[model samples]
Target chain A: MDLTFTERENAFRAECRAWLERHVPKESLGSGDTREGFARHLEWERELFDAGWAAVSWPKEYGGREASLFEWLIFEEEYYRAGAPNRVTQNGIFLLAPTLFEFGTEEQKARILRPMARGDVTWGQGWSEPNAGSDLASLRSTARRVEGGWLLSGQKTWCTRGAFCDMAYGLFRTDPAQKRHHGLTYFMFPLHGEGVTVRGVDRLDGDEGFAELFLDELFVPDRDVIGEVNQGWYVAMATTSSERGLTLRSPGRFMATASRLVDLYGRYRASAEPALRDAVIDAWIDAEAYRWYTFQTVTHMVDGQDVGASSSLNKVFWSEMDVRTHETALALIGDRLELDIDHDAPESAGDAVDEGAWMRGFEFALAGPIYAGTNEIQRNIIAERVLGLPRK
Target chain B: MRFAFTEDQLLLRDTVRGLLARECPPDVVRSAWEARSGRAPSVWAKLAEAGVTAMTLSEASGGLGMDELDLALVLEEAGYAGLPDPLVETVAVGAPLLEAVGTAAQKERWLDAAAAGDALIAVGFEGQPFVPHAAVAAVALLHRGGDLYAVPREELPLEPQVSVDRSRPIARVDYAPDARHRVDAGDRAALDAAVGVAFDRAAWATSCVLLGLTRRMLDLAVQYAKDREQFGKPIGAQQAIKHHLATALIRQELARPLVYRAAWSLAHRDSVRDHGAHVSMAKVHAANAARHVAKTALQVHGAIGYTIEHDLHLFQKRAWALAAMYGDVGFHRARVGAATLPD
Candidate 1:
């Protein structure tokens, strides 16, 4: 029931706040939502790491503070409250770091962990091929055995941040004879390796966050293999599990956004139509729900309960909330929303913040039900696993 | 800050769940539902004996010094069991209001008795569309002109009517000029604070009850879908049944954390203004979810569910009543939108 930080934890929060205040450039605020702007976000993450605060959940030996999960939660609250960054390195910090800590060898950890934690290297996911998105087990990516390494060849579409990353961790078909989830291997391949071409995909907003990767015999040494060969499905599942189930979304950051939106509505209240007001309220409620939901997750973590299928619910809830909120904002702005105004709320009687963010947000919201498994997928998980219903 | 419950709370949940399994089984709940008064005094007395009535009250007030989250678990379990009682009114609103805003004399006179399950307290907000189960309440608290009051049911205009859920009675109670208890306190600032806390607790607990009922409805539907068959195949094997149940499951799951988190926040008094939004979200999701689950369950059960002899309508009726109880999804969703996205 209690959501307050302990005295020591409050102190930790203060420390985090102080560090963010010093390192996060003032220009960084409200600067994300675009590829180049996101690059600046990566730079801020580097500063956070240099200040000894980035990825606090990682082991200290791997350039982390090795803090408890509760402390990590606190770090997230304070980090977002300070408006630090939008977490451009989320793939590395949230998904890969945990995998490396648990299953990778010490050498693998030593080689991959530090630079990634330091934000010096950005990594993209090479899991989804053109034909293997929903049925990921049907991936045809190949990694053939060789004297010094393995040769990988496949095309990975929908590679978020693929165009900006220097390296990628992939699940390739290491065993060509087998099919359907088995015979796969996890490999870490350099984005700049021979015969690799990454072409950015322009989103509706005219910005590129995803890319299509063409791999022509990319070489991945044996040392780069993660976990056992042909066991990448399980390893990949572990990554997906932690990403969906374990990690806590930054509640305070969204609250700040809500607060700002409130301010925005007030400034334009005279011009806001009644229907827009209604839309605004709908968006606000979704945001509030997210904060409370995260608090519940924090409670479960405090109680040492694994969130399990409950976490699946959150993935759907928060993502949809984000879309709804932005949509409301866009509607309130009217025709003015069509222009690009990223700095501050524009006074031009248009959507000063650009309708594109809202349009982009709506498109992205559709992905919520799609990614990390669709909402339908999560529903089945709940009915079968949590409710003990028959799968049929 | 940890948003999770302490180990003690987890253990408390386990204890309450186990107790309900034994005493509040489906048959027991069915009988309680069929009763004319909507609830049995003896059954309520047993709940009080189990300390369910006083779990969230201070020890000084002859009860446990548990927080709202702990009480939420109790409310949730009661809802899950479909126990016909005003547990939220008595516990969430009455006890906590007495603790936070009640004078020493008021606590001694009302809260202590309420904690002991002697003085059952309920609230009638905006009076007219009275909440089901308010007629039999010992005391009905209300909010008028930002002032909290405790008015006698006899003094107010109360018209008792049969509710959809026969287990809970509803009365359209109107306020009389001379019937209100003037809760004289400090200035406007302090009064709003006190009323706000009570509202948050009440709203959150209501949402929890709805969540419990919604989860139960989904469970019943899923179970029926598995057992009920048509044309030599289980109904659940059909895509229509699966999709219907799937949607219900979606709404139920979405409602859970919203209700739980709202309870958690109120118990801790974190972000006071946002409590209403959380409560609204929880209610919106739960109300809609419960109704869908109940309807789908009944539909899946065919003619069996429509009979007065069957228990399926009991849950369905409660869901229908609750959907309007805390403001419908549209009301709350709009409330949430305004509160969080005010600009």
Candidate 2:
């Protein structure tokens, strides 16, 4: 098996590395969860879209370069290596876009994909509700048959960046007679529609990163429904896999963090605990392992094998590794862990530590195991589905 | 880039796996513990006939001319069977080392026999205290003062050491390096470098075997969890047991790619530092996976797993023994750290 990148792939990497180096801001952008920060992130998204970098794996008709998955992975590596701002439109681009590509009608694709890629209409996930999480099929949201479309009514909580997003897509029970996983229809609706209200919720990091959506008979046209009605569970499972697997959390992200952690350890090597040193090394190795694992996965996908339940294993690993990488960085930061470093600080600040970025990163990493399906539920899926363990 | 074994490689792996299933079952492994030679010669001969022993040797030397990447899965199959032989020592390490540095006369004397599985060559690295299969081998290659010596087994003084897994017989070979025994008489420095790369190949091979042993332990645990019932249901129904096996499966799945990547690095002959780091990473991860899976398998099997009467102990002991060989987790981790972390 050949592991070295081809000449063309290396060229693609060089092109991406050059673009990211030139376009990425010198200073980190503000949290995309905040209103002003969302606007700023939107500008970066537009720049990426203009440069055909918004959706590298998507068809060119939709503002993308129609790059291969290997190229997409290369772009991600360059993206994170350049320390680019977090994608404020990730829920739409990463999670929903794959489903849309798979299940969206031609008309839906034409209307949604281009604007979505261009950041004209940002999208947030509306899957998890107050009652439905790990057991997502038990969602209480309903979509009643209407004259032209469906009338949706329910509460969708933890809609990441939903407070500012223009639209969302989720599963709704279309026929109450059928129990869990049945009778659900996937629908996309505008957040500011006639019967919808969005309220921001403060997250652990004190950012309005999550929103609660109250849908009161919101009218969604039949055109917005993805895939077949009553088969929404299947449609949404596609999105869940994307969220929990490769699209959302690429190995490049963790490798970048691991690199930073190594640098941080070097800065504190004189005073860092020996255990912390080992932790840094272990985290680095884990990241490297994840990178190769993803390559293996892409190889299989290229060979026509489906990821299926094995993505849960990927989720469990990267999510935990993300936490460990950040935790190690925080440990190296020592008592200064709680310092709220100013994002707007000058170039020379606090011995070039980036101050509280590690703390903020730690907070962000904390959400990984919780979101994209909790690690516990992923473990169950792995045991029963992947390993064929008996499920009582 | 393709990061997977080719069809031929996989076919070869399956052939070895099927052969081992028939010839080196648990009973054979059990018999090796009591055998005077601590080996199953029948299985070794079958592997030779199947071209496994000659895979890494050159075609000019009556061998397959395959590289580490081709034999990786085959090595894993060997580990899966817990075969009581010096396949890794002779095939993965010995033949290749001889092919690379052995004189033409040396190749004529031992390489052809090794490729035919008629002669077994055991290897002992400098830092390692014990030489595996030294008592049964026709010749033992020992490292001293950075020079490799090929001493005939008859001339070598072997002190047998009882391993936790008796199927794997290891020993201390006390042999003074002599001019006659020195294999790399032409270029000592180049020989030293070749020996260093051979050590990396050995480590990578051991990692592949560790992965196979880990998978075997996990499979036993999963099967046991399904069969062994408690509280009116199979114990596998319990979340604790399921989660334990699930975690082990995750480790196995993740560690495998690292091992495969190491095989690629060795096959491609990447920069010495890069390949060295890659091999160490593979060793560290595979060792961790084997260690964790062994514990989980034992815990899931309860007291039965502890007994020699049960088959689980065979793989568990093999995993434990191999996990510490070549380089343990901490040793490999430090190697990776040295390559990765800033000085």
Candidate 3:
């Protein structure tokens, strides 16, 4: 399909790119390094919010630009091209903001969405319990009905950014008497609230971006409930759909990153193995394909086609592609990859930006195919639902 | 802004679907497959009478004046029927190219004859002698020195090549330089646009045909799973069969929109940054999807599916053949890489 932007869209993109070049701090951008590097990355999000450039897809009422889906893509492209850090509040802004817009009450929107748009608050996901990673229906986290509110008690593992966030929105088993998927309810609980304990997961490089949380009778008001009680699975599914469905990255963004990787690879060419070059090319193709695929989806969405399954395919491709690109960078840096590169690292030292970002990328990419449903699951959806195969 | 087909396009799709249902049924395709000519001209006449031939040309040229994507819908249905007619060559390639580059005299004479079902046209390129459905055609478009010349079919030498696909007879056509009827336009640009449109349409039509075949493969797998017994239950109940079929469906689903998107973009002349990239992706994706589904269908059917007496191999052969058409997966993937890179 035709993938180029319109002149008007192009002009808008130029404006956004100009703004990004000025407002984004180069030091705070990710070299795909340590948890501290990610933390520094948040400063860029703060800058974007201050400049009114973040979360343009959110409704205007929540301090967003209320852009069309296509414009939103233009915004992301510019943001990525700027080489800004990944959003610390992506779960809140990309996933929860849309969820709140659709299913959240007006009051809830007023309370939670503005701070998120303003970069004043960060949110973490609390979906997977220790036993319920892929078979999400098997969650054991419990929340009992109380006189004033609900009392939550259970442990949530793999809680990304859980130890460092202001609040959490999770699916809790509000009715344990009901089995497998029926009894769960969605709740918005403050991570700093009483009776909640968070233990960060220590990585090989000592990054604690991921956490495990124990919710010991944490009280949450009925007002914090996202949608109808026990209907959270559907709501969660919808949220995941929006999370995966929208334009996640812009072509400009990938172009910038690919250029950076290419530069880094050139810098290390003497030490860099030939295999690394192949990986760079692979990353380049994936990034480009994903970019075109995204533009096509935006066109389809703008044209009013129901754009669900197609977006899933894009998510699967890009998420995996992101991992591959980052991993290639790590390989080029070799032993210097493990050093904790951060804002404090010397500007001239490549290791300052290496910090095993690629290894983490590999891990994250590995998880990507697993999270948002495995690639196998996506394939099944494509086959049965999209292709209309006879159900065996 | 609209991605869904316009009302008239929908009606055209329905009309073509109905016409194919009667004239190009499975039996007709089978009969043609069994015969020497590999095509039923009467069926082509019926399609021509239905105006499938003229739907892409301008009304002033005695045709419907539809865009390239509208004609794609007609071609897709024809592919589904395994219709051996040169509808793709005549309407999809020759007619559109003539409309773009033909002189007033040429369009007046040839366009009317083509629309009136009195002539058929085929494209002759230098490197590839094998033009799909080239035999039994009335007109040949020979490309040389970047210009397209209209050569009478009688003047060309065609060597019949045994093809894997029997539904369409292909021939390697050789042309002499002096026999060409040179046109006055910018031949290079015309040839470029024509080839692009032809590849886009062929890639998409082949994909939709694969879709139809894949859909049939999935059905066959599911039906066999339902009927066959294993471990005291229907094999359909087994996760192995169920999941295999499921994955095939996923690939098909993933590719369907892409095929339509490619066809739609070409039809409306949408953005070109993606120009060949999307179609390549669609073709590669569809080809792999169809191949996987067909292979899995045979595996699920176990013994009977492998027999030549069965229809499974027909889909398998078509998938293999279509995958090779319009450039194979490797070629199209490289095209995607080139299309997607920073300008």
Q: Using DockQ, give the best candidate's number.
A: 2
Q: Work out the iRMS of candidate 3.
A: 5.2
TM-score of chain A of 3: 0.87
Over B1-343, each residue of candidate 2 has an lDDT whose tens digit, in order, gives 8888899888888888899999999999999988746689899888888888888899988899998889899889988999878778898999989888877777888998999989998999988989989999988888887888888888898899999888878898777788788885468778987898889988999999999999888989999999999999999988998889999999998899999999988888855349999999999999999999999999999999989899999998899998999888888999999999999
- Model 2, docking class: high
* lDDT tens digits by residue: candidate 3, A212-314: 8899999999999999999888788777777666533455666666767777766787886656765665566555555555665666677777876655565
Clash count, candidate 1? 16
Per-model DockQ = 0.45, 0.86, 0.21
lDDT of each: 0.72, 0.89, 0.71
lDDT of 1 by residue, B47-100 (tens): 778787887788877888777777777777777877777888888777777666
Model 3: per-residue Cα lDDT over B1-343, one tens digit each: 2234566777888898888878876677667778846677778888889888887788877798877667656666765666766676688778877777766766776888888777787776545548765676666776765666776677767888877767667787766665237655665665677766665766666776677667667777777777788778777766576667766665555566667667766765555556576677677777877888888999999998988666666667767777777677766766765554322
Candidate 3 clash total? 8
TM-score of the A chain in candidate 2: the value is 0.97
The backbone clash count of each candidate, in order, is 16, 0, 8
Misplaced by over 4 Å in model 2 are: A342-353, B270-273
